[model samples]
Target: MKSNILTIMKKELARFFGDKRLVLTTLVIPGLMIYLIYSLMGSGMMSAFAPSEDQIYNVLVTSPSEEFVAAADQLKLEITEADIGDIDSIKQKLRNGEIDLYVVFPEDFDQSIASIRVGEAPDEPLELEMYYSSTEVNSSAAADIVFSYLDGLEESLSNLFNINSGSAQYDVATDEDATGMLFSMLIPMLLIMFLFSGCMAVAPESIAGEKERGTIAALLVTPLKRGDLAIGKILALSIIALLSGASSFVGTLLSLPKLMGGDMVELAGIDAGVYGVTEYLTLLVVMLTTVLVIVAIISIISAYSNSVKEATTYITPLMIVVMLVGLTSMFGNGAPTNPVLYLIPIYNSVQCMNGVFSFSGSLINTVITSVANIAYTAILVVVLKKMFDSEKIMFSK
Candidate 1:
């Protein structure tokens, strides 16, 4: 019995090691994929959070103090003296992301601090006002630096001065901008993954499963044009995938605020209702085109495969590519501007979605992406039609 068990174990081991593809997929590919993905994610997160070396934070100071200037210099802030009369214009710049920060100081700011440090307490703490747009990254970063320096200074001086003290909101960013920023970073990546999953679920079954069951051969013998058959399969698969993707998209959108934490949502005041019908309609167009592309690509791969399991195995690499492309939205400021980039299939969809969610996407780019995706799908359909007419592929044992 021991010798028989040993022989069985040897046979099993030999079979597992003999199939290079199985070994690669089950053992080698997973580790390599994890390493590559984590490396990319680490790099992406670093680039997203790390400030650039040459970044110059533009700041406007009113009634500037020597100590304040020194702090600004230390923080590498580029300061310009502004008049209180021009404060409204300066605020407009902050909201528009033209300037990083606007700091208002008391006329005798340094003198006030000196007097306060000598144990002279006033009826009210001296206040320093900082105005910035939270939606603008540079402005937010600048405000954080100033706040940190002031916090230390306040501690040393026994809280002699306070920063932006009160119920008054100093962040100049609009509610719409805040909503856009939150949605853009998360929605595009999620949308692509859902759409891809939808395609993966149906495409392999429709094409490769049919082939496995020998139904594809019978269907090929029918009077239906090969091109029509390909198009019909693609459209049917796309509709199914679209329904699946839309359901998930709606669920994700509805759940986002809750996912972001209820108290934080209430505090940040991010309203999902900020998006109008125009944005929704634009997103619908993007989703429809993206579904078509995903379905077409998957259908072709499924048709090329001889069985459902084989198709899924073949599609895994493409799934990884889709995930990598989806990650682009998390790293960039917005979509790429080049018209040519809108021609690449999966990438264009991700960028277009990114742009639309951010409210920074151009109409021309969206149009370009839609047209390019449709064109690619048509080409893929032609290729699929040719594959359908191939006897060697369809009738393969």
Candidate 2:
């Protein structure tokens, strides 16, 4: 029995080693995919959150303290004194991610601290208001640095001053902007992945499975034009994939708020209703064009393959590319402003979605992305049609 088992294992090893594609799919692709995924994610996260070494944080202070000025200099923070009348404008700058930190010190803060150090206890603790946007990375980092120094100072001075203490909200990010930022970062990547998965499910079966079963031969013999057949199949597959993706998209939107917050009270203002029909329509357009491009690409791969399993194996690399493209949504400070970047397939869809969800989507960019995707899909459709016409590819073993 042991000899027989060894003989069988040797036969299996011989078969496995003989099939280069099988070996590649089974071993090489998975390791490569994992490495690329992790590398892309690490790079993306670092680029998104990591501050530059030469970066000097811009800080706006209302009532400047001499000691705090010294501390700011040491911290590499550029301090600009502003009048109380400029608070609203300064906060607007923060919201726009222009400046990093806004520090509002109590009038005569030094005097107040000096009196406290002289054994004079005030009626109430002086509050230092630090206004920063949670959505802005620099603002958040600066807030941390400034707050740490103030925290140490407070401890030394016996809690003479409070930092952002009250029922008032100091983070100037509105509920809508906060919600948009979160959604834009996550939804684009997820949406593309879902669309790709949808295409993967049906494309292989429709083309490769039919070819494997010899049913596609019968269709080829029919009076239908190859271009028409290609168009029909692609359109049908795109619609089906869109439906599949839509289901996941809707479900994600519905459950996202709950995933974000634990309770209803915390999730009160975090509703998807912040997006109106225009935004939804914009998302729908992006998804529609994106689905067409995905379907066309998958169908071509499927046509080139002889079996469902082989088609799936062949498509794995493309799937990885799609995933990496989806990850571009997390790379920079919002979507890329370059109109030419919209000409690239898959990436354009992600950026368009990012813009719509983030409420900063340009109409020109959306138009460019849609047009480019449509053009790509058209070219892919032509290639697919040619593949359908080629007896060699369609009837491949």
Candidate 3:
């Protein structure tokens, strides 16, 4: 039985490595894509993080006080004051790259303060309008900064009048220094995506490829049992998935130079002590199980498929679901922390990666996730074994 298994393994391994196109799909092409992606990312990161050259903030302040106007001028902003007329045209110009921003002061802006002091309706809330290019996230941020300054000024004035007010508002951010956090989340997502794409890329060839060349019949004629044949294909497909995952990782690493930077995204919040050997082992276990689950999915579909085309069409949705699950987990920052999260297959893996990035990583969570993943992989393997046992897979036209 051992020799039969090894023999089947050797044949599948030989077929995969021996094929030139498969080799490229598994490694080279993915590597290039990763490099290109990272390089572009790096450029953007550099531009965003790098100090601005000739940093002149062009702003249009509408009906703003001389004191407010002077403050902007002191900060090296070219302040253009204009009435509310032609605001639409001004926004168009901003879009056409005519200016950086248009800052508008509220009409009856001073009266709103007076009304609030008397505890009446704020007839005019301090409307600091910042019209910037909508396409740029940076422009939106710059607008917010300017508005915040004006807001602070209003608050200070209110305080001078002893105007009792409710507590001021503030926004809490989780991504203030999210370097490694981004990477940890992105890496697992990329892994899942590449694996999915790789499965489709190789499955047709792995299954339909055999049928096309009449190799399935030849293999059947041999003493190698049907269950063993299924096992061999699963093993072969897993290798393809692994290669694809590796390619994407390489691509990501190369792209990092472009997508991020030389410093990487150094999250100050996480401590180094979290990444112990035990944590790494847990991660490895999850990764392996993840791979196995994907393999089982492919095996079931491929066995039923007459050609790779049919199998691919069948499995694309599964692939997309995996990618989506991984992405959804990344945004679960506000999700209630629980041990059950660690028991939920891919969800567990996502949380594990998140923990891996955090300062105080949870050892218990990692172990639970690992155990759950292994259990899931075992279940899938058994399911695949049953599918292989079906005589239809062996004898069907």
Candidate 4:
């Protein structure tokens, strides 16, 4: 029994790996594509967030005091004085990307600070209106720089008035929370997509390709049981799919730092210590079950189709559904606490991943999802066996 399954698995593996073109297209190309795409995206994001040194930022200031003007000059900023009435025109220019930022100071802005220094309540609270167009990268960058300047000004004013607001408070987010926020949203969706792509690449070619070439008939005529054949085919295809998925997974991990603005540890605000062996093992379990389920589904679809082209066409809708299900990780707050939700195949894997990555995954839920996936794969294998037994389905024109 083991020998028959191994023979079938070996044949499938040989057929896939023996062909250099198939191996290249199926395995090598995906990782390269992901790395290239993600790196470019990360580079673009960094560029957008950073200000260009060569480009002079146009700043429009309304009712600026001498101190404010001195600060602007000290920063080597290109400042334009505009009256309150010109605010509408300046906004229009901002929308047109003609200017980077505008700052409006209330008349007697310095007088308010002076009043506070003398222990007198100002007639009105000090206010400043700053505007920038977010759609323009330069405008946004300029706005960030201006915000830093204003923060410094605020600190200086507070010190001058001897206003002690206790000790400084730092960011309240913990390392786990930061890491969880970064990985939970991205990793689950990426894993599902890679697994599905891997299965899609090989499953149809294994089953439908054989059927289309009439090779399945020869195999059926042999002493192998139809159930064994189905199991062997599913297992072989799962191995290949797992390899493909792993390739893409590695690519994603390697490129994620660049994707998240080039500093993974800094960006996640956590060290590798955050995810211990337990989390990795949980992730591995989720990935293994996910590949099995995906491969089984694709195998069943492939068996039903008369040709590889037809199989791919039939599987396209399933791919779409997988992608849609993967998106749940992005919008979802975290893994749902309800155990019943863990029974939903692809969605369950996604949630399990989210939970595991966030360090909040339920072991019971993970176990349920894994068991449910295996159960579903078993059902698919049985259906595939029936399809194999049906001469009409196997040899249909």
What local distance difference test score does each model get? 0.80, 0.80, 0.67, 0.87
Better of 2 and 3 by TM-score: 3
On a 0 to 1 TM-score scale, where does candidate 3 land against the true structure? 0.66
Question: Model 1, 124-165: lDDT tens per residue?
Answer: 888889999887778888999889988888898885567887
The positional error of residue 270 in candidate 1, measured at the CA in angstroms, is: 1.6
**Per-residue alpha-carbon lDDT of candidate 2 for residues 1-397, written as tens digits (9 for 90 to 100):** 2443344334434544577774465435433554455456555666577677677999989898888998877888999998677677888999998889899999889998898788896789988899999888888889999999988877887865667879897777777787677778888999999899878877787789889999878878877677776777777677667766765666565544434433432544455678999999999998999999999999999999999999999999988999998888877767788999999999999999999978878999999999999999899989998998998998766
What is the RMSD, in Å, between candidate 2 and the native fold over all Cα?
Answer: 15.6
Model 2: how far residue 77 lies from native, Å? 42
Off by over 4 Å in 3: 38-52, 55-95, 101-187, 253-277, 331-348, 358-391
What shift in Å separates residue 219 of candidate 4 from its native position after superposition? 1.2
Q: Can you tell me which runs of candidate 1 are displaced by over 4 Å?
A: 1-159
Residue pairs with colliding backbones in model 1 are none
Candidate 2: list runs displaced more than 4 Å.
Answer: 1-159, 166-168, 264-269
**Alpha-carbon deviation at 395 in model 4, angstroms:** 1.3
Clashing pairs in 4: none
